[model samples]
Target: MAKEKFKDAEKGNAVEKEAEDLENGNANADAAVPAPLYPKMAEDPRARWAFIRKVYTILASQFLFTSAVGAVGAFVHPIPKFFLSGGLTSIVVFVAILLSPFIAMFPMLIFRRKHPINLVLLAIFTACISCSVCILSSFFGVKAFLEAAILTCTVFIALTLFTFWAARGGNDFTFIFPFLFATIHVLLVYLIIQLFFPLDRIVYTVYSLLATLLFSGFIIFHTESLIKRHGYDEYIIAAIDLYLAGVNLFTSLLGLAGIA
Candidate 1:
């Protein structure tokens, strides 16, 4: 009985020692592994990919609708004439066009997560933006619009590809956002000053070049944010970010070409 009791005590010690070893091993292993840079990204891969697909799909739809409206405004003489004709109706339409985005945007933000309502708001926002694009394109004529469209598409594709490659290589671009914000505000102030002062053509050219570069940076920044900072559930916000960047790029390109 004494021998048996001693043997049992030895067995218990061995088992306890094994468990302690396992616990230390696990701790060491965990310590060796790096923490995820984006915790939300560590969710299911399928969900993340699906989110990207949805965002791009929505963005494509937005571009298509804007392009269509732009075509109508540019090619259809009656529409542009009606809008550009100096009258109370034209003035009202012009003001409405300028204000439409803000009107739709606020409601969209409020209902961004509310399913079909959010979708409705998104459509309204897209239509508003489309109207603005259409009006701008109408001023530029078909040839200039087409040229700007081609250039914008090229720039957008290149930037998107570069963004993906840089992301894969572990580059981060979120840091540039503050600089971008400051620069945009400065540009807006400059734009307001330009409106009052009527700067030279060379100055306008420089301004357009700077704006193009700025919006290009926005494309890179926003695209990377989509891959890194945004979660799967923020597809609406992501789509809007990319769409705005695209629209701004086109407008800047138009200005760069001296067509706007």
Candidate 2:
């Protein structure tokens, strides 16, 4: 009887020890799991607002830099001519345009954890785009440039407000992605056609109008994505997306104004 009792006690102790070990293992597993670096911003109002603010601030700064560079390029007589004359400026602009996507991706790929490096790459990309803008604006003259800038800003602001309202109404813009992808390819084909066969004035005007509208849609979609779809850590990507939309809008407006 004592031998049986001793064996039962040993079994009980072993089971208790096994349960204790399982609990510890569970605790260790829980502790080992790391927190997410990119949290959903929609869950936190303060965080969302802060992220929006940072994104817009960066966007505004980029706009100002582009404008300043464009103005300098336009007024400085030799600069525009140099770029337009198929010379150094043209080569630089071409190279920049060709390499911009890679340059922009560089920070995201390698230096994402380093803010200074990301900022530098962003600035360089912005500068390259600004140089191209400067060359294009030079053809339009200052008055047209100013008009296009004003119109672009007005349209952008209106679309941004609409995006905010749509977000408040819990609208999802994910459905537009397929349409946008198709439209972009169509636009690219149209541009390639323009390169080979010069489009008539009416066709050019139509193209510009359509381009402006498309970019306006993009602005809304990107803004909505920034607010609702993107994580809090995606500020750089958000800024770049918005900046491209704005720049494209301005260029389309410039073309529509018959200045390009």
Candidate 3:
């Protein structure tokens, strides 16, 4: 419980830092802002590919690392093959994965690092903790589990693409805060219920779709805020928040897809 609160605090800090950037307008970070995070658009074809490359690199690394974690957990987990079928096992696995963003975000915020290798160990453990839930759930059926895992990965990919798209173009998806907040509030309540009750499959499906949409908007919104609009010259923290958003979105999608 304390861990969750800490994680939430971390997420809040990310937003606060971005707001600071917007208010202070520190010209020092101008170079790091890149094109999408830039206050104004500049014609840079390389910027598009650059963002693309970074995103794809993260996506690939995240999945491979996450899968490895799941595999390790499956071996040492001492849990039953029917763990995700229902009962306490499902609840345990479900809640752990669902709250993973909060878990990872809390620590990542306190000390941000630029180089991926600097935090590779932490990222691996975090991925294992979260992905273990998905892997255990998959034990119910390989095909079902794969679909869920793949769907989760797909949402993260979508978010990365959306961020890049928002950067390249002028669509400005930053205006969806009200709806996003409301949706997240509702989703949280709904998820709490699902932890104890049997939610309708249709509801899960709708929530899944909404999760993808919400997180995609978040990527575009946060990326723009941190660079061009918001003031997270502390790119390390900003990256952590964005990564959390992506990972949580993937987790949500996996839940829905697994049932589908």
Best by lDDT: 1
Clashes of each: 0, 0, 4
Q: Give the alpha carbon lDDT tens digit for every residue of 63-136 in model 1.
A: 99998898887787777787778899998999899999998899898888888888788999999999998888
Q: For model 2, how does the per-residue alpha-carbon lDDT over 1-260 read when each residue is reduced to its tens digit?
A: 99999999999999999999999999998776543223332265656778989999999999999888777755667765766688776787667764775666666546544687777878887877887788778877777788888998899999998878777766677788788878878888999999999899988888888888788889988998887777777788899899999999998998877534
Query: Which pairs of residues clash in candidate 3, taking residues 3 or more apart in a chain or in different chains?
Result: 18-231, 21-231, 37-228, 225-230
Backbone clash total for model 2 is 0
Please, what is the whole-model Cα lDDT of each candidate in the order they appear? 0.85, 0.81, 0.61
TM-score ranking from best candidate downward: 1, 2, 3
Q: For candidate 3, lDDT tens digit of each residue in 115-162?
A: 654366447445745565545544434454466567656665666567
Q: Give residue 216's lDDT in candidate 2 (0 to 100).
A: 86
Which sections of candidate 1 miss by over 4 Å?
1-41
Model 1 RMSD vs true structure: 7.2
User: Using Cα atoms with residue i matched to residue i, what is each candidate's TM-score against the true structure?
Assistant: 0.82, 0.76, 0.59
Q: Which ten residues in a row have the lowest lDDT in candidate 3?
A: 226-235
